[model samples]
Target: MRTILITGPGGSGRTTVAAATALRAAGEGTPTLVVGADRTDTLGAALGAATGPEPTRITPNLTAWRPDAAARFREDLTAFQTRAANVLDLLGASRLDAEELTPLPGAEELSLLRAVRDAALSERHELLVVDLPPTPRALDLLALPEELRRYLRRLLPPERQAARALRPVLGRLAGVPMPADWLYETAARWDVELAAVEAVLGDRRTAVRLVAEPGPAGADAVRTARLGLALRGLPTETLIANRVLPEAVPLHGLLAQQRKALAEWTDALPVSPVAHLGHDPRGADDLAALAVPGVNTGHPPVEWPVVDRTAEDGVLVWHVPLPGAIRDDLDLVRRGDEVVITVGGFRRIVALPSALRRCTVAGAALRDGELRLRFAPDPQLWPR
Candidate 1:
């Protein structure tokens, strides 16, 4: 399935674009699901459909939903609290209520991401179009898989030969209930769910379409979003310049100046396969016009960095290119099953592909600004 995420700074017409894209895809005989990630329920209204958390059919093969993040947050908190209560009870503690399990800060975004993953995996849709929040929040959602995986991996224990050595000693000291086994099992379950999300997000067919207005700030936001996505192996496919003034407008002083500035900014954008649409992008017809080939906004072709994997002499070599980043400014962090790279004042958290998580880091080197990390297969940690 192909997944397209449409996002940009607020007021950039992302919701309209997303709805239009969904309509076009459905017109082409593809089952499309458009999800509104924005807190405002404007996407459905733009499409002239009833707004609700449940999927509303807009076309023969098109459906849209404005998921209630607050409601989902409450439900997720309840479920988590119930599980925590059970686990706490097993350890001879009092049960805790859902009120105590309210999400701290990032929990709401995580829940939204879970909803997106579910839409992607649903057999009812062939294409998933996500109308994400503004650029910053959208980037956070994309980076979540790596962040959660890292935390889970660190909290859980290795279960093979290492467990043989550690469990016996811990079991003897604890006397009755062993917490390591439970922790490992919980971690394993999380691992499965995270892997499913990573698979859907990291697929090449899953592309991010950056929507931006013809202005300096909008251009910068798009650039940052593109760079962040690329660092995480999720590349931006199309740069959509929304709300551009038409050429027919009388060319004079201020009006001409604004048009020239827009033209220059559009040309300067980095990612290629660009397209331009009007400010008043209204219905499916307007969107269909924008999706037409050869809109040509003049951006460079996007080349995604590859993660090269090789197993040699019992060590797995992972060569990650950290171009234009200095070693002194780089921060490498391993949180559970995720690796975070901070370089050149920019940070990107990456979800380790399933194959790499089975290995332990043998050594790491940051030479000439390229961070290369080596890992060795850890048989003890490999799931049987």
Candidate 2:
């Protein structure tokens, strides 16, 4: 399915933009699903209806949903308790009832992954519109799947599952009860689901649409969002300049500020201006008035291609593009087979390419928003 991930700074009308875009696609006879995980029910307001944990029909071709994170948390915990009942009983641990359970802080954000994976994989919708949290939070949420999967690998180590029969013997030898088989099974299931969600995010057909009111603060937010996403290799296709003033509105105050921001944005990326309707957006009429663009052919997924420079520079260069990155805020550390890239408040651990893995980090620099790392052949590891 083709998907559009919409996000912006708080109060930037990203939810409205997402609703309008999905409505536009549905109006044109495409099957569309718009989902959100925001606690405020913003997507429902934009859709002129209430949404819930279940997908609700907004129109013949459009469906809307706001995943119930608390409910999901309760269900998951209850199921886990059931699976590990013997383990709990053996340890004399008390099982908490579902009624008294409350979701943890990040439950809401992580719930979005399950929602997206289910909707995208079902083949029931042709276009999916995701109303993500404000850009900063959304970027972190986007990174959650990969990060969680990494943790899962470290904790559960799927390879250890092969010795399942030996678990009992090992536990006997250690004179302590080993974790139940259900634990590894649950981790494996979660890993599969998280992988699916990560695939949806990294798919070539998925495009990120950045929404922001054109102003100084919005400009800064947009730049930060762009840099953060680029650092993670998620491509941003367009900037939806939301709540724009009319061109004829004297062009002297807010309009002038907006115009200036738009000019800057236009130079750096494609801009789609959504005129303000002079009120908070609500219902179908308001959404239509926004005139948000429908989904477009998305760009190819970002790649970290290695450039050969062994002849001239005696090293190979690995290029990682991170637009809008500042030199002062960037840091890199090579950790075994992987490199940890820290830019500002964001960080990503990237595995090295096979050829680069055998070489040592000769030098590294951030130039023109691209991070270039030079690798010199290591006599010990590289083929002689």
Candidate 3:
């Protein structure tokens, strides 16, 4: 299955583009599912159908779904309370009812991400089209699985969980409470779930389609978004310049600026200009007429590998592709088995390959949008 995530600056008509793209794919006889993250019925309006948490057939081969974040939040909290009932009873704590629960700040995004993961893994749909939040929020949402997995590993290392039988004995001997068996079980389950979601995100069949209006703000947003996406090694399929004014419109200056933006985008990725609809697009026919082109999915970037040059320079170079990274904002550090990379405001800690872990960072450089680090093998650590 191919998963295409569509996002852009808010009010850039990304949902409309997403609907049209799914409609086009369905028209070609592909089984396509369009998933939306909006709290309001934006996607339903574009598809001219009512959508909810359940998947609804919008057309012959297209299905649309809007994740009910509030409901999911309630369900999750209620289940959690049930799981911890024993502890709550001992503490005389009252369990909150689901009816009184409301979704917290990031609950909607978490629900949307879970839906995306499930849809991507399901065999029912050949194509999954997701209408993600605007660029900033979407980036954060996409990065969540990896970040959470990292936290889980740090808090409850799997190695420690392996000795579950000794936990009680050790806790009694130390006269302190170790993590309960249920806590370890919960961590293991969460890690598995997060790994599945991360797999979907890092899958070769998944790619991103960026939609933006053709103007200064949109251009700036795209550029900033590109840096973030590149740092994460997310492949961009195309740039959809949505709501482009016609050439003959009274706003000739705006049209000229759009032309310039389109040309610039063409050089970066496939540029597909969606003309201004004058009114919000409604119904399948209108969406189909919009002619939003689909893109071929590209495999995500390969991992940074150690290129040994021991014979010539006694150095190993690790090459990491960061397409839009600014040289001034880049930072690299080697900490034990993990290398911490900071690009702009985003940071990721990636574990080094076994061979690279025995080496020390000698120097680093950002050239041609790729960050290359030179490492020297430690004589004492390298296998004789």
Of the candidates shown, which would achieve the greatest lDDT relative to the real structure?
Answer: 2
Which rank order by TM-score, best down to worst? Answer: 2, 3, 1
lDDT of each: 0.69, 0.90, 0.87
TM-score of each: 0.72, 0.96, 0.95
Q: Write the per-residue lDDT of candidate 3 for residues 2-90, one digit (tens) a residue.
A: 98989999999999999999999998889999999998999999999989989999888999999899999999889888888888897
The worst-scoring run of ten residues by lDDT in candidate 3 lies at 295-304
Model 3 misplaced stretches (Cα beyond 4 Å): 295-305
Q: In candidate 1, how many Å is residue 383 off?
A: 29
Candidate 2, superposed: residue stretches over 4 Å from native = 172-175
Q: Which candidate is the best by TM-score?
A: 2
Candidate 3 global TM-score:
0.95
Stretch of 10 with least lDDT, candidate 2: 291-300
**Model 2 agreement with the true structure over 185-298: per-residue lDDT tens digits:** 999999999999999999999889999999999999998998899877888989999988888887688888988999999988889999889899899988888878767767
